[model samples]
Every structure is written in C-alpha cells, then in structure tokens.
Target: MTETTPYDADRARFTRQALARLVLCDHAVDVADGAAGLVATENDPDSGPGGRVSQAFQLIELAERALASAVIYEREQGSSWAEIAQYLGIGPAQAEERFAANLEGWNTAFDVPYRLDETGRKRIPQLPTAAYDPAWACEKLDRWAYVQRIGIDAVSSGLVMAVPEEELPSVTP
Candidate 1:
C-alpha cells in the first residue's frame, strides 16, 4: 500500500500561492512571445507605434485565454461557480456564462488525444491554445508578469489567504 502524507496547513497555503504565481508567470510568457513575434514582423520604422498596440491587443487576448484555462482547471478540481466567481470578483452567473462560452472553443483548440481507464474510452485533454497566436502570447506574457508582481504583493501582505466562513461578516438578518 502507498503511504499517505498528512496535509500541512502552511504547506497547503504556500502551494496554493505558488500555483497562482505560476499561472501569472505563464500568462506573462505568452504576452512576451507575442510581442517578440510582432517586432520581428515590422518592416517600417514608422509603424512601430501601431505594432506596439497590436502587440498589446494580442496580450489581452492571451490573458483571456489564460483565464479560460484557469477556469477549466478549477472546475475540474471541484471548485464551485460561486467560489470561482468570488475569486474572480464577478457574479456566479456572469462567470458561468463567460467561462462556458470560451470553454468549448478553448477545449477544441488545445485537445490532445488520450484514453480513459474506467470506461476504456478514448479522449483528449484540452491544451492552452495561445501558442497559435504568437504575438498575442507575447503580449499576454507581459500582462501576466505584471499581474504576478501584483499578486506577490498581495500574498506578501496576507491578502490572498482563504478566510474562514465563521470569520466572514454575516449577511443574514
């Protein structure tokens, strides 16, 4: 039998924070890749400003893609819509609608073939599709890096921890 390791509260907290940071870093990498690609495509010095804006747009698209991936991963890990919505600072319905809209496309774009053991069925895992848009990926990387920096501040300040339900202010009459 495999030995089970007991959960350490501090370790759990650290792991969660680390994962968030990783997600942010991934987004930044995507943005950087996109920007680099756009720079390589510029033939006219006069179009530099326009190319920069294009690169920025690509980064926004990459951020959207990264958020989509996070949503999917969280859902698969059993996170509730309400919890996710709270984390995203959005209403549950809005989160569901936004995620659902892009979920299918994201899945289709990144799906990799695989097989299931339980049902002996074949399947594919969804992969991040940002790579398809190199410029967007680069821009996304930049934005993600910025977000990560902000997150680091929040984490360091103890603002990223999960509050106990009892500690939350009551809304009931």
Candidate 2:
C-alpha cells in the first residue's frame, strides 16, 4: 500500500462519479487560479521571472490532475473504454492501461479508506483531498460554479452534486 494522509472514520458520502467531479472541479479551479496568479504576478513589480515560471509549472501539475479526474469521472458514468480512447486518439487498450491505476485507486478507497504511513503509525487517506470530505467539496464547488457564470446545474461538470441516498424518494422498478 502506498503512503497516504488524513484518514477519517467517515468515508465519502458521494458516489464515485460525484466524487470524481469534485476532484475534477477542484483541479480545474487550481489550474485556473494558478494561471490567474501568474498573470497578476506579471503586473507586480516585486515579482521575479522565476516566480511566474514556477507558478506556470505548478499549473501543469494541476492540469494533469484535472485530466485524471476527468478520466475517473468518465469511467464512473458508464463511458466505455472505446469512447474515451476515441476522444484521446489512442487505442482502447492504451487508454485503459494508462488510466487503470487511477481508477483502481479510486475504487479501492471505498473499500479501504486509508493505509499506514512508512512509520506504520500514521494513517493516510487514499482519496484525493477534494473527495475526502463531501460537504466541503459540494459547498465549494457549488458556489464556485454558480458564481463562475456557469448558471444552474446541468451535469457532472456543472454545478451541484449527487443527492444523498437518503434524500432520494423510493423508486419502484
């Protein structure tokens, strides 16, 4: 088991797709915030070139996390490997192989929420920071999306999150 941080007794309350969306949105916001900071840095006289360059590099990492979140969200939504591969312009096998670990780690988090650190004492959370706490993610993402001029919720990428199981009315199949 890989090292992790922040293991809470309460696991995620959201479904895989909802959690994935929060992760995606969080990363997306980070990338946007980082880029905006870089732009602001350019106007600051005290800012050095290294500062802007370093922030730009951080944006790359944020963007990569955003991409991974997207892939995880897609899989949870019943998107086939072939469909993702088509968009990625790679063969299905290639796409699956590339992202298998990310999906596995996500799925496993529900079963085993955390693992011991190298010292075998401290517990680490397996889920990403955004997915670890549902309420925080929903509030932050909802407010962010609504204020971002995206308007009301539409889908996973849009504002809002999955309704809690208890909140849903019973459906007869």
Candidate 3:
C-alpha cells in the first residue's frame, strides 16, 4: 500500500531545489569567508593577497545568479507581477521592467549561440500544472484572486500560503 499527501510531491521537489540553492549559498559564504579549501591562506608563504577579494567577488556573482534564478523560477510557477514585486519589496511596474531588463541582459551575456527557434524567436517551454490535485489548485487560485481583490502587494516566496483572516476559524481558547 502507498500513502499520499496533498503537499508531498510538490514539497519534495521544492525541498530539493531549496536545498540545492542553500548549498550554493553556503559555498559562496565559505569562499568569501576564506573557509574550506576555497583558496590558499596568507599563512601559506606562496599565497597571494588577492585571494580574499577574489573570493568575495565570486560570492557576489553567485548571489546574483541565485537571485536571478529564483525570479525566473517564480515567474514560470505562475507568480504574478505583484507577487514578484512584493517579494522584491518593489512596485509591480518596477518589478516587471527590471525583470525584463535582467532577462535581456542574461540572454545577451549567457545564452551561447543564441537559443532561438527556427522562426528566430526564443523558445519557451510549456509550464507544468502547479499542483497535483485540482481541488488544491483552487486554493492557489483563490489566493491569487485575493491578492488581486485587495490591490495590495502580498509577499509570496512559493513556500508559504497566506490564508485570509476572515476564512480562518476563530479559536475560543
């Protein structure tokens, strides 16, 4: 017999990706802090003084990549402009503009041989379903609607769900 839970599959995938990102972040920290085998220390007579500075630069570059990757992931997961803006602590218009600019810069700098289709347009993959259960997907739809209804920027990091205050059951205790 097999057991299933509403959050199992999605949570597992999210947990794996989240752990990978954390590992990258931790490595960045280790490099920047001169821990681990990131670079030779000054105690080593042959080591150069530029080691720490270069490692710090690498940390910044890795952090930038992590942030960009997160934004792209959120977008592909059906996050709205407002949700992204809220996460970034910016306005929706600014978020959209900045993301577009960043996407262009990323493509220009990182895309090797230019990944385009036969029509000369960039190829975009079809998005997968957000959740396994259609009923659970309804909650996500409601959350999106709630975000739109109030016209307030709501922070969403793809892990937490924000239930409306009214919908929450009152506790007598």
Candidate 4:
C-alpha cells in the first residue's frame, strides 16, 4: 500500500517552490553581473550610474520576494510561527506579522491533476477534445507517479491506486 500523509503534500509543495526560488535567484545573479559590467563603463553615459544602480535595487526587490515565498513554503510545510521566527531571527509575533505583510498580494495558485480509480479508470473527465485523448490518460498516470514520489496516499487520489497500461486507449494510424 502506498503511504500518504499531509506531510507528503506539504513536502511536495515545498519542493516545487524551492525549485522556483532557485531559478529566481539564479536570474538575480545574472542581472547583478550584467549591471556590474555596465557600472565599469568608461565612456557609455547610459551605463555609467543610472543603469547599474537601478539593477542593484532590483536585487533587493527580488530577494524580498524570494524571502516571502520561502516563508509561505515553510508555513505550508507545517512549520510553526515560532520556528519561522527563529529562522528569521525575530520573535514569533513579529515573524508572523512581517510574513503576512509581505504576502499581502501573493497568490498561491496551483494545479491539481485529475483523480483515477484503482481499475485504471479516470475518476475525472478530460477537458473537451475532438476525440478520445490518450494524452489525458497519460497525464493522469503522471500525476499518480508524482503522488507516489511525494509519499502521498494514492487512494486519496480517488478509488483504485494506479492506472493499468491496458486501460489506456491506443491510437491507430
């Protein structure tokens, strides 16, 4: 039996966000490097001061956004306010207040895959298509694999656990 728990969901969410944060930070570094080069310009007036300065400020803005995302990720992973506070080097109340302030306009939107019954039947209907969509069935199987990776109970996905390969309709040319 696949083991599923709330912790698994939280962990998967955290993993996804962490990857996004890494990519954002990497971009910030690239931006800073470009700005540094512009700052060293000998004759280009446009690159002398204004350009690099604005880019430098952008680094701060990106860092702040990344920090807020981290806070949200931690919370979703079942972290206590006090724990976050300790990580931020602030009191629990202050941590909560600051995080809330930062996340005021944040959106935690995400997509959920369709559920499937144990007999490899789709629990949710696929979106409108001209004909039977094999890709939709493939996507459902992918979702199940992801659930398994996250240690979440596949049963929570719906009825049966996995989609049998034979259940997927084959396309004929």
Question: Which has the greatest lDDT?
Answer: 2
Candidate 1 lDDT tens digits, 81-165? 9999998899999999988965565445433323245665533323332333334444666676576465223222332338866
Q: What TM-score would every model get versus the actual structure? A: 0.41, 0.71, 0.37, 0.39
Every model's Cα RMSD, please?
A: 19.0, 16.2, 19.9, 23.2
lDDT of 3: 0.50
Which pairs clash inside model 4?
A: 4-152, 4-153, 117-160, 118-160
Steric overlap count per candidate: 18, 3, 0, 4
lDDT of model 1, residue 88: 88
lDDT head-to-head 2 vs 3, winner: 2
Off-target runs (Cα >4 Å) in candidate 2 are 1-12, 41-43, 146-173
> Could you give the candidate ranking by lDDT, starting with the highest?
2, 1, 4, 3
Ranking by TM-score: 2, 1, 4, 3
Residues 97-159, candidate 4, lDDT per residue (tens digit)? 888854443332223223356786544422111012333323544464465455433233333
Tell me the lDDT of model 1 at 153. Answer: 30
User: Model 3, residue 80: what's the lDDT?
Assistant: 86
Candidate achieving higher lDDT, 1 or 3: 1
Error of 2 at 66 (Å): 0.6
lDDT of 2 by residue, 28-90 (tens): 988887876664422455657686678878989888878878999999899999999999899
Cα lDDT for residue 109, model 1?
Answer: 41
> Which of the two, 2 or 3, has more TM-score?
2
Candidate 3: lDDT of 87?
Answer: 80
Residue 105 lDDT in model 1?
57
